[model samples]
Target: MNLIDKYITEVGKHLPRRNRADIEAEIRSTLEDMLEERKQSPSDDAAVIELLKEYGAPRKVAESYVGPRYLIGPRMYPLFEMVIRIVAAVLFGVMLLVFGLGLIGANLSGPEFLKTLGNSALSLLNGLIVAFGNIVLVFAILERVLPAKDFEKELEDWDPKELASEPEPDSEAIGGPGEQIVGTFFLILVLIVLNVYPEWLGVGFFDEGKWVIIAPLLSEAFFSYMPWINILIVLQIGFGIYLLRQGAWNMASRIANILLELASIALMVVMLLGPSLVDMTPEKLAGTPLADVADFFSKGANLLPWLVLGVVIIISTIEAAQGVYRLFKSSPRSPYPVIK
Candidate 1:
């Protein structure tokens, strides 16, 4: 083959299979035109080579365009962006609905509805933005670290690892009865201390008294703390004990997470429901002993939080119990004697 043809072949090898032929034809046609222009001058090999160099080597031209290939091209991503646009539109619609509902509720009922709705809308918007940002960040990192095309090729077929045996739960990993009791008590103590003086733990929203209310009952001497607080602590302790006895740390952690979620929900419910439960008629509510009125409203408002917390706690407990039952059921038991 001639030098020009050899150079053309080398350059064509570097181009993608889809565009290689078209690119090769274009290069060949251009080179032929250059040769035709120089033929009349009868140029030496060095002059011809210099002319070809001026046109740039095929590899250099190819390398300039050899960066990333996108699943969604930049042009398409910007002008035809589907996911983000759809998400934003949905969120806007949700905001409008929430605002409309808030207006209707407030006009029909009272001003407190407006306050609650506004707070909830702001929170929802903030949470959605934060969540969207995090998800985008995670996906961007994954794309950079592990290209989707390569990942797809690698995982196209399954491997034996897919069916590998899972290890049985070791008795040693789950401590003895005594150790469990001690560990559970320690966890309970930490949870309680964190609740009592939450700022001490450096967690966000700890200072928000909405986390745990300490309402003064009618008989203050009889109860130094709110009656519900005592009930919750007892329930939490019971939950902890159950976790320890079952040796289910996973379940315990989930229960803890659910408790935190319920706490936040309780705060929202209070802000929404507290004002309505009050005797807003002015005369009756104002004339009644302030202490008695405060006590009644506080007690009533307090009930919802506990009730919501109880429902969440119960649901979490049931889920955990089911998980534990499934795990134990799948585990193979050995033929051994237990000391009764």
Candidate 2:
């Protein structure tokens, strides 16, 4: 009802809801104690204002309680910056691709070419802005929802000797927040594209004067493996989420990663050895301008599945091998040589 109540109310406005009451009470108590110690009249409005001024502004006082708040906090800022850089690069690449495709079979030094370039730049700028906004929103949500203890421990528990010690085979950095976030994002992109926009697998070409998409490029045999492939991908996504929460890798995660990689490799191997994954035939393109090269491309299409699956299998195998070796390999992190 008085000046002090008004002051404390202002301070409470800035404090978090969870701690507002306790903090307001503490501030009131401290003010009262100071007034008692001063041996002054509680009704002295002028003296109370002076005391409040000494304590600092309401926002400043609240800040003292909560520390600094951010849309993206210190711990996640590095990852946010990295994601921004990646998104910017991807957008630039997309712009270049669009511009390059437009330049194809067109006069390069014309007004139309300049117009096309301008349109591409505008599209790229819009894309960059949207991507940046979405990334900030996601990181802001994560900053609020994620627990702080794991990050706190990572900061608090430090040993300078770690730099000198031999790298522990189990001490994998896959659980680093930056990598986990990037990996999860990439996996989700792949999941959406394959499941929701499977037609994107088709090749794009210019026909007559317009861009055309030649779809139905993948065969039924490829769709048959989707269930299994989706399962492994979903499992890996779940595992990645767990690791991000943990903020450090452990024995279980190491083992789980190897198993997932092996499963992927096995599935890829089956796709490679079994029925053809591509469905584009010479007959399919007979009506198009590509008819002349259709036969050559048809043969290459048969080999395309092999090329794609083989590359995936090889990468998976290499990753799995690393995980397996690390799981079994143990070496002392000693600075001293064996005395025996």
Q: Model 1 Cα RMSD, Å?
A: 15.2
Q: Give the alpha-carbon lDDT of every model.
A: 0.53, 0.82
TM-score for each prediction? 0.32, 0.55
Question: TM-score winner among the candidates?
Answer: 2
Tens digit of per-residue lDDT, candidate 1, span 1-340: 6666777788877789888888878887877788778772224566657666877887786665566655444433542344455455445555655565445334335567667677668966885797568656655555566665765766686586754543334322344444445434544654565446533321112123333223222232212333544455566567656655455344344545366435534544444443332222323334344445655555554464347555755675665565455445544466497768
Question: Which residues of candidate 1, in runs, are more than 4 Å off?
Answer: 1-68, 71-111, 145-162, 167-292, 298-340
lDDT of 2 by residue, 1-340 (tens): 9989999999999999998999999999999999989986668998898889999999999999999889999989998997888677657766776787777545577797998899899999999889999999999999989889988998889878776653333444554355566677768867997899887566556669775676467888999999998998899899888876665556777889898998888888888888888888999878777688988878887888888888888888998998888778774366678898
Q: Judged by lDDT, which candidate is best?
A: 2
RMSD of 2: 10.1
